[model samples]
Target: MFRFFESLIDPYPGAVPETPPRRLLAFLFHYSRPLLPLLLAMTFFAAMVSVVEVMFFAFMGELVDWLAEAKRERFFADHGGRLLGMAALALVAFPLLVLCKSLVTHQSLFGNYPMRVRWLAHRYLLEQSLPFFQDEFAGRVSQKVMQTALAIRETVVKLMDVFVYVVVYFTGALVLVGRSEPWLMAPLLVWLLGYLVLMRVFVPRLKLISMAQADARAHMTGRIVDSYTNIQTLKLFAHTQAEQAYARGAMDGFMETVHRQMRLVTQLTVSLQTLNSLLLVTMAGFAILSWHQSLISLGAIAVAIGLVMRLRMMSDWILWEVAGLFENLGTLQDGINTIAQAQAVSDSPKAQELSVPQGEIRFDKVTFSYEAGPRGMDDGNHAARQANVFDNLSLTLRPGERVGLVGASGAGKSTLVNLLLRFFDIGDGRILIDGQDIATVTQASLRRHIGMVTQDTSLLHRSIRDNIRYGRPEASEEEIIEAARRAHADTFIRQASDPQGRTGYDAHVGERGVKLSGGQRQRIAIARVLLKDAPILVLDEATSALDSEVEAAIQEQFYALMEGKTVIAIAHRLSTIAMLDRLVVMDQGRIIESGTHQELLELGGTYAGLWQRQSGGFLGLEAAADAAPIGAAEGQTRGEGEASVPDRQRQ
Candidate 1:
């Protein structure tokens, strides 16, 4: 039975709106559509429960009058059937209705509703473009996703329950009072008006404060998470005090918002208690005066006082319910800021799967700038935005060609690779793999045909085997080990174990592979990419962390891995790429020189000068010197740097 209720709604709905509504009511209605019928059934049961309680009160008044006016011998004869029927309802039917409401609520809606909401919200977040994540703290974004789900569930379900019960219960009370003496309804009506007035004044103020509180909490969480993620850097720099101070600033902001919210809550409590006291006093006085004037029965006076006392108790509960509703609504609004935005990047409706046979790559006059704003929006900011990373830049690699990229920092080397991967859509022009434009192909398919290894490799906190198999899920165990061996990663992996004693491939890597050395992490990353075996490969300072012996050991394997693939390699250690088929030297986002290493050396251009500046196989340039054009120097004839290459190579 429990499982039956849990399965009533699919937790992961197949279809969802691309953009969620921002307005509270619309947002609630949108997510609630699947649960609406069950929710309405619950509301009906709540209303019936309210009606039963009111009937019980009326029955009590009737019984009081019956005992006073009837003889003891004839009491059962006069009211026996009705009394027995009411007893049965109280014992059986009333409990059943309450049970039905509870089942729909606790057993079904409460759990499934939030889970469904979170699933959809998480899906929407996954669809967001790379820049969206780059712009926000990861921890804060996840917190909003989690908080919004619970807040929406609490706001909708509790508000529904409270609203239905109050309305039905109040209406029944008013009718019971009016039947005794229509004038007796005055106090009840006045009390209700004052209650609404209080809600009107206090609820909006609570909502605003709650929203501020939610934002502050998220900000504080983001700061702490940032510190933790960079804990190694903190420890290395010995800045524990500075880290604490940085986190404290966010903590103080959060406390200020919390203080404001508590102040409003205190004020609201005092005002509500005062109003409830007046209602109880006024209703009791009126009931007694009506009975003295002979305008109402003893039973009517009893019912009036009873109803007023019950309301007095309920008013406090109602106050809290209304306050919590607005507070959750405020939280929902904060969540909406993260979850309701439309996807900045999405596949075109008619996009096709990318197919790469020859692995030919082309950049046809591509132009791009990160400063163009997300979604490539062009506004007044465009005029003041930073210069384009690539402007009318064009490059191509023939099938199975191996080329190296040589440039200083900010020379557009990485940006060019990012554009080819379609991490950001180009501001103009097109990138094609083979003949199909990348923009016209599904992103998943485009990425599947390319494999890349970066200097700053990050691994999932999963088993070594699982991380390697991630490149191809169906790969067998033998294949995984072989790939690791080729990447020369198998030696240390055999010795690897987590604190849990799980050894070798089964052992878990710590967060972001922090348990592993930089070289070990890079080797695992290389192994994974090797398993992927894509037709196109990119290496961006891929071996920067390895010691000379290990680097030399893997150099042959890397050459083999590059066979029959179009490769683009980037390295500060120019020697690693100097032996490739060709070298392309970029400066200020344009390809300034391109040729074989020997040819470029013969040209005595930018590439030759950069080669001349290398020490121990790595670019050794001072900050200011790298900025200036390093073309052939004055008083040095062509091939002057080329003639000295052998001597430096021997060093």
Candidate 2:
């Protein structure tokens, strides 16, 4: 019993696999089995209560008939003691049944089941690959998870409620009353057939509209969160009205779908009410006629009327229950559609933990396209023609070599690094670390061997101390402070203060380190990497945010940190890479020039031309394309900068 509740805590408790069509049933039953015994108890006791309800009407009829003075005194004398005992037993049982139902219901519905389902579903979602998240909104995904769990609880509860009552009450009513006037039961039979037909026609339509409304609601939520997350951008663009209009468009879609659903509900209610009214009137009229004809007792007429009224009330309640069930069904279908997807890339069944002895990296005859065009289009035919990010590019980094990759935007520099990190599996050829194929190793183990610092440094919304410790969770405080000092982050960290009354390592950096400056975030990132101290290091525009003076000061520490580590540095600033062992310049994803900075300049090749145009030893996107020809500006010194690309050339 304890294990059953424990099972709920881990949403992904190694569920058996199911086919797509059976997924909904499998999802429901997976979490419901634990409560099977309770559900059965609830169903049995609850059904007996309906039987008691039917008896109550019969009791009322019997009491009324006995008071009429026709065989009244003798009937009481013969059966009064037994009758009183039965009434006392019923009075005790009614509240007992209701109490049992309430206690079981509270545990099953309002206890931990819904939240457990939610936790499990969300945990399953967390296992989906990066691309899956990239394709949808975080807010929408979270919303779907919540809806799916609630739907599970509501769907089960209502199914049991409606099914139990409809079967037990209807069957009991038919058996008890039909024995006397069997012909009068025809209206109820007709009502049953009509109700079935109505549900069959209207339920699907209700489900469709409900699904649309859920989607619209999710989309609206995503849009509003998108705006909140980028509030600064909206403020900078001065587009408050534009944002409102965008949000209004989503709201309109949501409102339209909801209105359509409500209209269907109203129509169904009126139609069901009319059918119920006809059933009530027909049963009452037939009972009066039967009594007048001397075919049944006066008590039977009252009993018939009471049963008809009870059936009317039950039918009305059941209709709304079915409607609520349908609404939740639509939500469940939507949730399953989003949450259930085949994982794009996962660790191979036989993949092993990576053991990096010496991280000598190599790209062996590699070729890859992003599987979509630059514009993110994926027309089936066009995918085959997608332009390659890298083609037949081969490179080797000897252990502990510090080599720099210099390239313009879109030249596949990041793609190469991304592939090495196994963020995306390669299309062809192999990326090897220590001669071990990356694809054959678990991603967690593979990534642990490499440390990276990119241009856009994002930090968690946590204290500076925690963020730095994130790199190496078990690192001693002394080591953490040492890393910060090496990365030159300790001084500003100690002096910095914000409106939140926090300073230094204890201060909270807002989401993506929004509370800190560009340089501050970069230094924290650098400290993190320093704390990590992986065998392989990648610096993609690592010092781009630092001014020249700071860059010069930090370069000494960076070089010291890079010693004896296999380093792959990418920088647009010429001076940053000028002192590296070799400069491998690329254009269009192919190596154009390679050698030391002086050696390449002496060669008077593309690198030489580019060297002359660099400003403050840095190359910007516009300048890289419009660099003067070799020796064109020999008299002019560096830092004058190249002009922007010609419009025709850019086109």
Candidate 3:
């Protein structure tokens, strides 16, 4: 029965949740609509349980009066049947109702509701644009996702279990007291009004405090996780003290919010206790006076006292539930702010799947700027206020063409590659793949045809086989091994063993492949991309991490991989790209020169100047400063100063 209830709702529903409403009730209703039937059943059982509880008190009153008046001999004949029937109802029906309620609340709603909330929320978050993640703390965003799920579950389940039951029980108690003697209802009526007034005053204040508390907790978590994520950097820099101070700032802020929340809770508790005392004293006095006046029976007096005492205990429980409800609501609101955002880089309404049969990429008069930020907003003149990474910049990679991008840091080399991958949308003009506008195509399909290996590679915390096969999930073990071998990663992988004693392909990689060396991670990344075998390949300093010997060996494999694919390679090592079909020199968001390595060297232009300044196959820092401009209008090269290669070698 527990298992049946547990499996009643799908934990990971495929349907996307609708835009969450800002209003608390609306948000609750939106998520609750799917499980409305079960929730309704749970509420019914809860109310029935409350009703049975009230009937028990009513029966107790009747039994007290009967025992006082009935003859001892006839008592069994007269009231035994009634007492036995009540016992059967209490033992059988009441326990069954309570069991059903508990099953739904604990087994079904507790587990499944939060899982669904997280699944839907996580799915929505995945669709958010890259910049959305870049702008926020990964730890904080994740904290919100997790916290929101539990909060929503607690809020809903508590409402069904505690709030609904309390309301029905209280209403029944009021009716029971009034039927016993009209005077008995007055004290309860006054107490109910005062209880509501106190709640109205304290609950809202608690809610506001809870919001601050939740936000503070997430911020503290983010700060701590940030420190942990960059622990190596902190240790290398010997900045442990500084890191502690940074985290301590967030912790102190969280403590302040906690203090404020607890202060409010203390006040609410004191106020509620006072209200409870007045109700108990007033009900007792009224019950005693009614019995003295002979206006109510002895049993009526007993019932009134019993009901009021139960309410006193219940009031405290209700107060806690109500306070918690609002607190969770605050957390839900905080989570919604992070998770319920519109997608910034969604495809067009009529988006089509991109097909790249020819592997031709064209940047047609493209313009882009990271300065205008993710939303692409700018002040005043669009061009004047913004510093563009690319402005009216156009380049093309012909089908199966091997092109290299040469530039210094901040010269838009990586930016151009990012643009090609559509990681960031361009400001003006369109990028097309084989005559189809990239913006009009679905992002997944567009990326499906492109394989890229970045300089900074991060691997998932999974086994070696899993990370390698991520590029092509359906690839067989033999194919994976083959790909690893081609990338020269097989030897290390074969020798690898994690702390858990899993060796070779089964060995787990630590977070972000931290367990592996830089070269090893790069090799694994290369193996994955090789397995992917996309038609359009991008290599951004792909071989930068490997030693000369490994690089030389991998060069042949890269050549094989580049065959029949339109390849764009970015490299600061001039000699590595010296043999490419074309090298485009970029500076300050504009292309200054473009030709084959020999052609550019013969032409004696910026590329030639950069080539001449190479120190041990890598461009010197001085080359970046000196190779800024070309007298292209006059068709003349900049003068090669004393900072040239021969001068540097002698120095």
| Leading candidate by TM-score | 1
Q: Is candidate 1 or candidate 3 better by TM-score?
A: 1
Task: List model 3 lDDT by residue over 1-651, tens digit each.
Answer: 888999999999888555677677777777778888888888889999999999999998898899889999999999999999999999999999989988988888888998898888888788777767877888999999999989988888788778889989999999998998888899999999999998899999899989999999999999998998777789999999999999999999999988888898888889988988998899989988888888888888778889988988989889888989999989999987887776767777799999998989999988776545443555657654445556688888899999998865556677777767777777888899999999889988998899989888889999999999998999999999999999999999999999999999999989889889999999999999999999999998898899999989988999999999999998888888777789998765678889999899899977887777778898774535644453231111111111121211111
Worst 10 residues of 3 by lDDT: 642-651
Give the deviation of candidate 3 from the true structure as CA RMSD: 5.4
User: What is the lDDT for 560 in model 2?
Assistant: 87
lDDT by residue for model 1 (254-285), tens: 99988888888898889888988888888888
Write down the RMSD of all candidates, one decimal each: 5.7, 6.0, 5.4
Error of 2 at 225 (Å): 0.6
Where does candidate 1 clash, by residue pair?
Answer: none
What lDDT tens digits, residue by residue, belong to model 2 across residues 261-336? 8898888989889988998888888888888898877777788788888878888788777877888888888887
Candidate 3 off by > 4 Å: 16-23, 371-385, 622-627, 630-651
CA deviation > 4 Å runs, candidate 1? 373-376, 623-651
Candidate 3 clashing pairs, residues 3+ apart or interchain? none
TM-score for predicted model 1 compared with the true structure: 0.94
Ranking of models by TM-score: 1, 3, 2
- The number of the candidate with the highest lDDT is 1
Instruction: Give all TM-scores, in the order shown.
Output: 0.94, 0.85, 0.93
Residue 343 shift from truth in candidate 3, angstroms: 1.4
